[model samples]
Target chain A: MIEIKNIIKSFNESTIVNNVSTTFLKGKTNLIIGQSGSGKTVLLKCLLGLHTPDSGEIIYDGVSNKKMNDSSKTLLRREMGMVFQGSALFDSMTVIENVMFPLTMLSDKNDEEIREKAEIAIQRVELEKAYDKLPSELSGGMQKRVAIARAIVMNPKYLFCDEPNSGLDPRTSIIIDKLIQEITKEFNITTIINSHDMNSVMEIGEKIIFLVDGEKNWEGTNKEIFKTTNQSVTDFVYSSELLKKVKKYL
Target chain B: MFYLSDIGKYFIMIKMSFFKPSKWKVLRKLIFKEINDLIIESIPIVAILSFFIGAVISIQTALNLSSPFISKSLIGFATRQSVILEFAPTFMSIIMAGKVGSYITSSIGTMRVTEQIDALEVMGINPLNYLVFPKIVALLFYPFVITISMFVAIFGGFLAMTFAGVPSEAYISGIQMEFEPYHIVYAYIKTFLFAIILATVPSYHGFYMKGGALEVGKASTLSFVWTSIIIIVVNFIITQLLLS
Candidate 1:
C-alpha cells in the first residue's frame, strides 16, 4: 500500500499538484482520473519519484520518500514497475529481449534462468508468438502487452501505468484494462493507473480519485461514482451524451 | 546566463555519468556496440576524406612552389606539415562533429521523446551511464582513426607528388625533413579531446531536449552547431597553449 500525505508539487511559479493526499491499497486498481492539464501526469510523476514534491510526503508502505537516500530510492525503485503511455519498449530489441532487459541488468541469475523467467512473463501476457518481433512490428495492443510483460518480469511489488489505454481502440483498451486488473489482483501489487477513460474507471477502478485543477475533487468506488452528488465528479463522469444516458439509466 | 547554466549542467552530467557503473556484462555489450557504431564505422569516411585531401594538399603545394629556386621535395614537406598539424586531426574532427554528433543527438532525442530514457530511470538504471559512458569509452580508440587518416593522407600526397613528376626520392626526403615528434603528439592530444567532445555535447543536447519528433530534429541541429563551435574553440585554445 502507498500513502500520499498532502503532496504538493509545483513548477516554476505554477503549482501542478496541490495538497492531495490519498491511500492506494494493495490488490486493487486505484485510478487517478482527471481531464487534460488537470495535473494527473504531474501527480503520477511525483509518485514515481521523477518529480520531487515541494511539500508533503509520500510513504511507500512504511518508508517515507523524503527520508530515503539515493541508494535506498534506487533499491525501492527496483521493486517498482512502470508501463508508459507510449508502451516505451526499446525500439531495437525483440520482445523477449525487452522483457529480459531488467533481469539482464539487475539480476544475479544466469542467462538461461533469466530467459526462463522472461518466457513465463511473456506467456502470462499471452505474447509467446511475438517473442522475436521488434516493437515496431507489433500492433498498439501487442506493444502494450509487451510493456506489461516487461514491467512484471521482475515481479515488482508496485506497478504504475501512465494512461495505459491511450492510442488503443476501445476493444483493445478493455483487454489491457482487464489484464492490468487481473495482474494486480493475482500479484497482490499496489497498482496505480493514471487515466481519464470512463470505461476504465467504471470497469476496473476499485478506488478512484478525481482531480480538478490539481486538487482532489472527489474520491469513491466505481459504484459510488454514479451515485455521488459532487458536481465536478458528475460533470466529468458523465461528460459524454452516451455516458449521460447511461447515468440516467443508472 | 543560459550558457553558464548549461555549462554547469554539462559538467554535472559528466560527473554523474561516471557514478554507479552498470554491470560488467551489460557494460561490455554496450561498449562493444558503441565501438562498432562510433569508431569502427568511422574509418571508411576518414580514409576517403584523408586520401583526397592529402592529394589536394600536395598538388596545391607543388603548384605554388613552381619557382625554379624552390626544391621539389618541399611539396612533400608542406603536405606533411598541413596534414599532420591541422588537416587530419582538426579538420576531420569537425567533419565528425557533423556526422557522428548529429547521429548521437537524433538517436538519444528520439529515445527521450518516446520515453525510453524515463523507462530506464524508472527501472533504477542510470540512463547516462548506460547511454553516454559507452560512447565515451568507445571513442577512446579515436586516435586510432586519426592515425589511419594520417597514414592514408600521406600516402595520397606521395602518389600525387610522384604523379606530378616530382621524384619519389625527393618527395620521400621532403616528408622526412625537419619532422618534430612533438607535432604528432600535439595532433593526437587534440584528437582525444575532440573525441570526448563529440560524444558528450550531442548527448547533453539529446538527453535534455524537450518536446516531440520535430524537436528531436531541432535538437540534433542545435547539438551539431554547439559541437562544431566547441571543437573549433577548443582547437584554438589547445593550439595556443601547445603550439604557441
Candidate 2:
C-alpha cells in the first residue's frame, strides 16, 4: 500500500499538483483521472520519484520517500515497475529482450532463468509468438502488451501505468485495462494508473481519485462516481450529452 | 549564469557516469556493441577520407615548389609533417564530429523524446552510466582509428607522389629525414582529447535536449558545431602548450 500526505508540486512558479492526500490499496486498480493540464501526470511523476513534491510526505508501506538516501531510493525503484504512455520499449531490442532487460540488469539470475521468466511474462500478455519482433513491428495495442509484460516481468510490488490505453481502439483498450486489473489482483500489487479514459474508469477503477485544476476534486469508487453530487466531477464525467442522458437514467 | 550552470551540470553528468554499474556483465555487452557500432563501422569512411586528403596534400605541396634549390624529397617531408601533426588527427576528428557526433545526438535525443530515459530511471538504472559510459569506453579506441589514418595518409601520399612523376628516392629520403618521433606522441595526445570531446559534447546536447523530433535535428546540428569548435580550440591550446 502507498500513502501520500499533502503532496504539492509546482513548476516555474505554476502549481501543477496542489495539496492532496490519498491512499492506494494493495490488490486493486487505483486510477488518477483528470483532463489535460489537471496535474495527473505531475502527480504520477511525484509518486514515481521522477519529481519530488514541493512539500508533504509520500510513504511507501510505512517508509517515507523523502527520507531515503540515493542507494535506498534505487532499491525502492527496483521494486516498482512502470509502463510509460509511449510503451518506451527499446526500439532496438526484441520483445523478449525488452521484457528481460530489468532482470538482466538488476537480478543475479542466470540467462536461462531470465529467459524462462521473460517467456512466461510474454505468454501472460498473450504475446508468446511475438518474442522476436521489434517494438516497431508491433501495433499500438501489441506494444502496450509488451510494455505490460516488461513491467510485470520484474514481479514488482508496485505497478504504475501512465495512460496505458492511449491511442488504442475501444476493444483493445478494454482488454488492456482488464489485463492490468487481473495482473494487479493476481500479484496483489499496489497498482496506480494515470488515465482520463472514462471507459477505463468504469471498467477497472476499483478506487478513483478525480483531480480538477491540480486539486483533488473528488474521490470514490466507479459506482460512486455516477451518483456523486460534485458538480465538477459530474460536469467532467458527463460532458457529452449522451453521457449526461446515461447519467440521468442511472 | 545559465552557461555556468550548464558547465556545472555537464561535469556532474560526467561524475555520475562513473558510478558502479548495476551489472558489469550487461555493461560488457554494451561496450562491445558500442565498439562495433561506433568504431568498427566508422573505419571505411575514415579510411577513404584520410587517403584522399593525404594525396591532395602531397600533390599541392609538389605543385607549389618552384625553387630549383628545393629538393623533390621535400614533398614527402611536408606531407609527413602536415598529415601527422594536424590532418590525420584533427581533420579526421572533424569528419567524425559530423558522422558519429550527429548519430550520438539524434539517437539519445530520440530516446529522451520517447521517454526511454525515464523508463531506464524508473527501472533503477542510472541512464548516464547505462548509455554514455559504454560510448566513452568504446571511443577510447579512437586513437587506433587515427593511427590507421596516419598510415594510410602517408601511403596515399607516397602513391600520389610516385604517380605524379616525383622522384621516389628523394621523397623516400625526405620521409626518413629529420624525423621527430615525438610528433607521433603529440598527434596521439590530440586524438585522445578529441575522442573525449566526441563522446561527451554530443551526449550532453542529446541528453539535455527538450521537445520532439525537430528539436533532435537542431540538437544534432548544435552538437556537431560545438564539438568542432571545442576540438579546434583544444587543438590550439594543446599545440601552444606542448610545441611552443
Candidate 3:
C-alpha cells in the first residue's frame, strides 16, 4: 500500500500538483485521471521518487520515502516496475534483452535463469515473435506490449505506468488496459496508471482519482464517475463527444 | 545578486561535485566499456594521423639540423623529445576533443532532449552513474589508450626516416639524447586532466538540458567549445610548470 500526504509540487509561479493526499490500495489498479497539465504525471513521478514534493510525506508500506536511506530507496525501486509514455524501451536492446535488463543489473540470477524468466514474461504478454526485434522495429502498440513485458519481467510488487494507452487505437487501448488489469490482479501488485483516456477509465478504472488542474477533485469507480454531478467531472467526461452521447443514455 | 555569484556558484558546485561517485564493481565494467568503444570507434582516424605527425616532426628536425654535421647522438634525442613531449599528448588530445568528445555530447544530449533521462530517473536509476560514469572511467584511463596510439603515431615519422636509411641511428640518438621521462610523464598527466574535464562538463551540460532538439544541439556546441578552450588553457599551464 502507498499513501501520499499533503503532496505539493510547483514549478516557478505555477503549482503543478497541489496539496493532495491519496491512498493506493494493494492488489488493484489505482488510477490518477486529469486533463493535460493536470499533474497526473507529476503525482506518478512523485510516487516513483523522481520529483521530491516541496513539503510532504510519502509513506510506502509504513516507511516514509522522504526519510528512507538511499540504499533502502533503491531496494524499494528494484521491487517496482514502470512503463513510460513512449514505452521507453532501450533502443539498443532486443525485446528479450530489454526485458532482461533489470535482472542483469540487479539480480543474482544467472544468465540462463534470467533468460528463462524473461522468455516467460514475454510469452505472458502474448508477444511470442518479438523477442528478437528491436523496439523501433515494432509497431507503436507492439512497443507498448514489449514495455509491459519488460515491466513485469522482474515480477515487481509495484507497477507504475504513465499513459499506457495514450497513442494506441481504441481496440489496442482496450487490450493494453485489460493486460494491465489482469497482470495487477495476477501479481497482487499495487498498480497505478496515469491517463486522460475515458475509454480506459470505463474499461478498467476499478479505482480512480480525478484531478482538476492540480488538486484532487473526486474519487470513485467507473460507475460512480459517470454518475457524479460535479460540474468539473461532467465537463471532463462530456468533453469527449462519445461520452456526450453516452451521457444522453446516462 | 551581482558581484561574486560566479565565484560563490563555483564553490557550491565544487561542494556538490564531491558526492564521490558510488564505488561499484560496475566501474570495472565501465573501463571495459570505454576501451571497447574507443577501440571500435576512435582508432581509424587516430591511426591515420599518428605516423603523419611523427614524420613531419622528424623532417622538421632533419631540415633544421641538416646544415652542419649535427651530433649523431642528438638525432634520436630530437625525434623522441618533440614526439613524446609535445605532439604526442597535445595533438592526440586535440583529435580526441573532436572525435570522442563530440560523440559523447551528441549521444547524451539526444537522450536528454528525448526525455529518456527522465525515464531513467523514474525507474530509480541515476542517469549520471549509469550513462556518464562509464565515459568518465573510460576516458580517464583511456588517455593511456590514446597514448598508446600516440606512441605509434608520433614515432611513425622516425620509423620512416630510419627506414629511409638517412643515418637513422643518428636520428635515434638525437631524440634519445634529450629524452626526459618527466616530460612524457607530464604529457600523460595533462591528457588525463583533459579527459576528466571533457567527460564531466559535457555530460553535466547534457544531463541538465531542458529544451528541445535545438537546445540539445546548443548544449553539444557549447560543451565542445568550452571543453576545447579549457583543454588548451590547462595544457599551457601544465606545460609551463612541467618544463620549468
Query: Per-residue lDDT tens digits of candidate 1, residues A105-174?
Result: 9999999999999999999999999999999999999999999999999999999999999999999999
| Stretches of candidate 1 exceeding 4 Å from the true structure | none
Top candidate, metric DockQ: 1
Number of backbone collisions per candidate, in order?
0, 0, 22
* Per-residue accuracy of model 2 over A1-250 as CA lDDT, tens digit each: 9999999999999999999999999999999998999999999999899999999999999999978999999999998999999999999999999999999998999999999999999999999889999999999999999999999999999999999999999899999999999999999999999998999999998999999989999999999998899999988899878897896777
Q: Candidates sorted by DockQ, descending order?
A: 1, 2, 3
DockQ of each: 0.90, 0.86, 0.38
Question: What CAPRI class is candidate 2?
Answer: high
DockQ of 3: 0.38
| lDDT against true structure, model 3 | 0.79
Runs of candidate 2 with Cα error greater than 4 angstroms are none
- The C-alpha stretches of model 3 lying farther than 4 A from their native spots are B1-30, B58-80, B113-125, B159-170
Q: On residues A1-250, what C-alpha lDDT tens digit does candidate 3 reach at each position?
A: 8999999999897899998998998988988999998999988998888888897899888899877998888888877889988888877779998888777766788889999999999999998898899888999899898888888888888899999997899999999999999999999999999999988889989889999989999999898998899999889888978878987996
lDDT score, candidate 2, position B115? 96
Q: State the displacement of the C-alpha of residue A6, model 2, in Å, after optimal TM-score superposition.
A: 0.8
- Local accuracy of candidate 1 as per-residue lDDT tens digits, B77-105: 99999999999888999899888899999
Better-scoring candidate (DockQ), 1 or 3: 1
